[model samples]
Target: MRPDLELVANLIQTDARVLDLGCGDGELLHNLQQHKSVIGYGLDKDAENIGLCLAKGVNVIEQDLDEGLGNFQDDSFDMVIMTETIQSVHNPLLLLQEMLRVGRECVVTFPNFGHWRCRLHLAASGKMPVSAHLPHRWYDTPNIHLCTFNDFEALCAHLNMLILQRRVVNRHHNERSLINLAPNLFGSYGFYHLGRTT
Candidate 1:
């Protein structure tokens, strides 16, 4: 499992209902089910991923995230999760609202665009940076609204979302002591557990 997913799995309650958005091949969901005893459902637009989910005996639905999530009723799940896919969304804030609407809490992880490496690369080269975490050319990348850790926190505040927990780690997914001091600059990825403010 990816280090971020490992941390996410630890956040889930045993026997909780989980809805995973852009759930790739259901790897995280599968892990959650087996270890945490959670009931998991996955949503992915890719047909190949949907097939993989089925083969793994995981329940999955085919849906485009950009089209919105009207099918799920409010507070239908204990937790919703979206990992490594937020930057690709057309309207991340709207999607986050929907996630909180349908689930009591949500876990989201994304690459931190404000990391020193990315900033230095752009400053020195006058072009977008492509690193191990963000391994894509600017034109062909799926990421549309890349953001920093600060940017995401501000958005959550603006949306009245309460961050329950946060973790910042390097590209290897290891937490460094220094990340606590300057997360936006040193953290390569950010994982957040958030809920709607009461």
Candidate 2:
């Protein structure tokens, strides 16, 4: 398993029902099912990913997140996870609110566009930054709403979501403690545990 996934799995509580949005290949869900004894469901727009997840004995649905999740009732799951896919979505804030609406808690992760290396690249090279965490050229990148750590936090605050935990991940997915001090500039990626305040 990837280190980032391992970190995510560790954050999840045992025996909790989980919904993983954009769950690619079902690796994390499978691991959670095996070790934590958790029930998991996945939703992704990609048919190939859904097929791969189904082959691994995971329950999956082919659905676009941008269209919204109308079928799920409020607090339908214990936790909803959206990892590395938030930046690609059309309406991130609305999606996040929906996640909160449908689950008691939500785990979200996204590439940090304001990392120091990216800033340096922009300042020195005057070109779009490319790193191990975000390795795509400007035109071909799937990310549309690239955001800094602060941006996410602000959104969370605006939506009245309470932050339970926050972590920064590097290229190898190693968690970094320095994130608490300067997440927007230093962290390459941001992981958050959130819940609705009211």
Candidate 3:
């Protein structure tokens, strides 16, 4: 499991039901099921990933997340998780709302576009930075809605969601306490635990 996913697993209560959106290859779900005794269903658009999930005995569905979560009823699960995928979605805010609607709480992680390295690289090279966290060119990158820590917090406030916890990690996915000094500029990735306002 990615270090971030391990951290995410720590946030989940044991034996809870979880929904993982864009759950690549079901690694996180598999970990959650095996280690935490949680019941998890993964959703991914890729057939290969779904096959991997099936091989691992993890329940998975194939669907584009941007299409919306029409099948799941409100408050159907204890938690919904979207790891390192929010930036790739077409309408992140709408997806977030749907996530909150279907689950009591949601966990999200995204690459921080406002990291100083990205800014400095862009300033120096006059091109998009291709680092370990964001390793794609501007034209081909899937990250459409890239944002910073502050931007994400502002979005949460705007949506009237309650942020239960927040962590800033480096490119290696380890929590860095010094990053808190200037998370928007220093953090490479952001992990957020959020709940509905109500």
Considering every candidate listed, which one attains the maximal lDDT? 1
Top candidate (TM-score)? 1
Clashing pairs in 2: none
TM-score ranking, high to low: 1, 3, 2
Of candidates 3 and 2, the better by lDDT: 3
lDDT of 3 by residue, 74-175 (tens): 999999999999999999999999999999999999999999999999999998888888999889999989888889999999999999999998898766
lDDT of each: 0.94, 0.88, 0.92
In model 1, what is the error at residue 92, expressed in angstroms?
0.3
**Which portions of model 1 show Cα errors greater than 4 Å?**
none
TM-score of 3: 0.96
* Stretches > 4 Å off in candidate 2: 176-180
- Tell how far residue 159 is off in model 3, in angstroms: 0.3
